[model samples]
Every structure is written in C-alpha cells, then in structure tokens.
Target: MKVSIITVVYNGAEHIRDCIESVLSQTYPDIEYIIIDGKSTDGTVAIVQAYGTKIARFVSEPDKGLYDAMNKGISMATGEVIGLLNADDFYRHDRVITNMVSLIEQTGSDAVYGDMLYVDRDDTQKLKRYWRSGWYSDNAFKWGWMPGHLSFFAKRTLYETCGLFRLDMKSAADYELLLRFIHKHKAKLSYMNEVTIVMRAGGISNSSLKNRLRANREDKLAWELNGLQPYFFTLWLKPLRKIRQYISKPPVKNAHS
Candidate 1:
C-alpha cells in the first residue's frame, strides 16, 4: 500500500535536507513524500526543490501554523496511509516504513505506531531518552498513553472521517486528534513495540517553560473537546506519562537498527 509521509516546516533549512533524505531513502518504494513549508525565508524551499520530481507534492507559502501546514498536506495526500515526520525528526532507518506498513497490514489495524528516541539535536545517535509506547489498551487513553506523534500513521480514510488537525489548538492539536481517533471513533491502533522514528528534543511544545504550560492547558482542553472525563484532572497525567520515557530500554540492536 502506498503511504504518504508529510513533513511540515517553517524556516527549517538546517534540518530539512536530512528529513527529506530520510524519507527518500526508505526501503518502501511506494511512499509519497509530501512537504508543506510556510514560506521560509531560509533555503528550505530550495533544498526541497533539489529533490524535484521525487517529491509527490511540495508547497511553500504562508500558513497559520504547524497544524495548518499539516492540514494542507493531508488535503493533498492520495496514499492509503498517512504519516507525519517533522522537519527536525527522521525515520529510524531505511526499512522503518517498510516494516511499519507490513505490521499494519498483518495486524489489520486502522492505525499503527512504534517507539522513538528523544535525541540531542546535534548528536542523533546519542539518545537522551527512549519513548517506549506500550501495547494499546482500551483504557490507555484515560491514562494519557499515546504513541509519539512522529511515529504514528493512520489510514487516509480515518483522517477523512475524523477530520484533520484543529488549527485553533496551538500546541495540542495532535493530542486532540489522537483522542478523537482512539476514543471517539475507537480506531484499532496497534503498538509495534519497535522504534520507528528519531526525534530531536526542543519541539515547540516543550521549547520553553511558557510553552510547556500552554501545552498542558491545551491537553486539558483536548480532554473536554473529545467528550472525555475529568478534563481538569488530566493535567496531572502529563507528568506521570512522561516518566516512562526515561525508564524504558531500547529494543534489541539488530531488531531496531
């Protein structure tokens, strides 16, 4: 099945090349690489153009924000499955997508996700922490168990039915989207228990104390938006959920590498 990997960026010239290369070098040949850039002043657009025909669709223009850019990419995606790879993150290996697609087909899941590493920006291999996404459970959402956004992939039809990211949600649009998918629609999501992507630390949500607080507020808002329970209490769940990252170990070297 064809999978569309979308990368959303704004003035991300520094890491855009590596991100595009990671998608292009995937062993899965059926991937459609789509990029949505927010009219970067840097050379991000030029770097993407170097790939030219290899990119199924590339657009550079002003956007509302990250979620808006992602929404635009989703609108242009034609593949059966869709995934997001932020400009600062990259696939773990060339075979990562190949294996993820296989697992999705084998398990007959509507969505699938794997583990990921939080690595230093300059030292990709020196993982700062492991994001171990345990297997899915019906009650997992209540406890804030979500796969890393960078590693999650869902069927395009799912997006069509559930709707795209909410531009109003400044930081937690992804959290809200996951809640709708797993809780409201009850999508069959599978956890592969293997690393699928590597993300550099310092994303907008956690970039600063103020942003982190904003993320917490947005997450609480997500709980209410999806018609879930205890919206206010959900704020405490965030810190507890993050503790798993430092405590889990990586998968076997041969299996993951």
Candidate 2:
C-alpha cells in the first residue's frame, strides 16, 4: 500500500532537503511524497524544484499557517495511509516506512505508530525520546498519551470519517486531531515499538517562552474540547513524558544518518 508523507514547509530552505531526502530514501517502494510550500522566498522552492520528479506533488502558494498548509496536503494526498513529516525532521532510517507498512498489513490496523528521537541542529542525536505507545487502551488518552504525530501513520479513511486538522488552532491542531481520531472516533491502531522519526531541536512550538506557553494553553483546550478532565494534569504529563526520552540512547542510523 502507498503511504503519503506530507511535509508542510515555509521558508525552510536550511532543513527542507533533509526531510525530502528521508522520504525519498525510504525502502518502501510505494510512497507518495507531497510537499506543501507556503510561497517561500528563501530558495526553498528552488530546492524542491531540483527533485520535481521524485516528489509526487509540489505546490508553492501562500497559506494561513502550518495547520492550513497541512490541511492542503491532506486534501491532495492520494494514498492508503497518510503520515506527516515536518520540514525540520527526518525518518530514523530507510526501513522505517517499510516496517510500518509491513506491521500495518500484518496487524490489519487502521493506524500505526512508533517512537521518536530529538537531535540537534547539526542532526547529531541529542536525546532519544522514545514514545512508548503500548498496546491500545481506552484510558490511554486520559493519561495524556498520544502517538507522536511525527511517527504516527493513519489510514486516509480516518481523516475523511473524522476530519482534518482544525485550521483555527495554531499549535494544538495535531493534538486535537489525535484526540478525535484515537479517542473520540476510536480508530483501530498498532504501536510498532521502534523509533521512526528524528526531530531536530528548535521547532516553532518550542521556539520561545511565549510560543511554549501558547502551546501549553492550547493543549489544555484540546483536552477540554475532547470532553476530558485533568486539563492541567494532562498538559504537565505531556512534557513530563519526555523525561524518559532524555535517558534513552539514540538509535544507529544508516547513510541517511
């Protein structure tokens, strides 16, 4: 089955190539790489144009923000499974997608997920934040557990049945979408129990004190919107979960490393 990997970017010339190459290097032959560029002026378009044929669809136009750009990618995706890869992140290895495909097929699950790693700007592994998304549980959402969006792959039908990212919410749209699909809609899912994506430090959500606060407040809103209690508790649990990540060792990468 084909998996559509969407990379939403705007003026990410410095890191876009790494993200693009990660998808292109996936051992899985059936992959639709979609890049949604927000009318970048910083040579991002030029870089993307260099790999025109390798990319399934490349669009450069002004967008509302990250969430809006993601919505556009979702609308354009033509694959059995849809996964999002930030412009500042890359897959853990060439076989990550291949493994996800095999696991999804073997388990017959509607969605699949794996762990993640956090690296420095130079792509040097700084910390391994293993997202231990264990077996399915209805109460997992209550503990504020979510499959990291970076490594999660959901069937396209889930989006059509539930909905795409909420364009109005800034930082918490991914969290909200996860709540709706995994908790509210209760889509069947599988956890791969392995690292899948590597996120570089200094993402927009953690760029500044103000942005971090906004992300936390928006996270509370996600819990409330999903009709879950423990607003403050969940918010705290979200970041606290990363504490385990700081202790784990980084995985070995191939040439893509």
Cα lDDT tens digits, model 2, 109-208, are: 9899887777777745556345555566876776767788878899999989999988767778888998888888888889887778888866554546
Which regions in candidate 1 have their CA more than 4 angstroms from the true location?
205-213, 231-233, 255-257
What is candidate 2's TM-score against the reference? 0.90
Please give the distance, in angstroms, between residue 21's alpha carbon in candidate 1 and its true position after superposition.
1.0
The candidate that wins on lDDT is 1
Error of 1 at 47 (Å): 0.9
Please report the candidate that would top TM-score against the real structure: 1
Once superposed on the true structure, which residue ranges of model 2 sit more than 4 Å away at CA? 128-132, 205-213, 230-232, 250-257
lDDT of 1 at 81: 96
lDDT of 2 at 142: 69
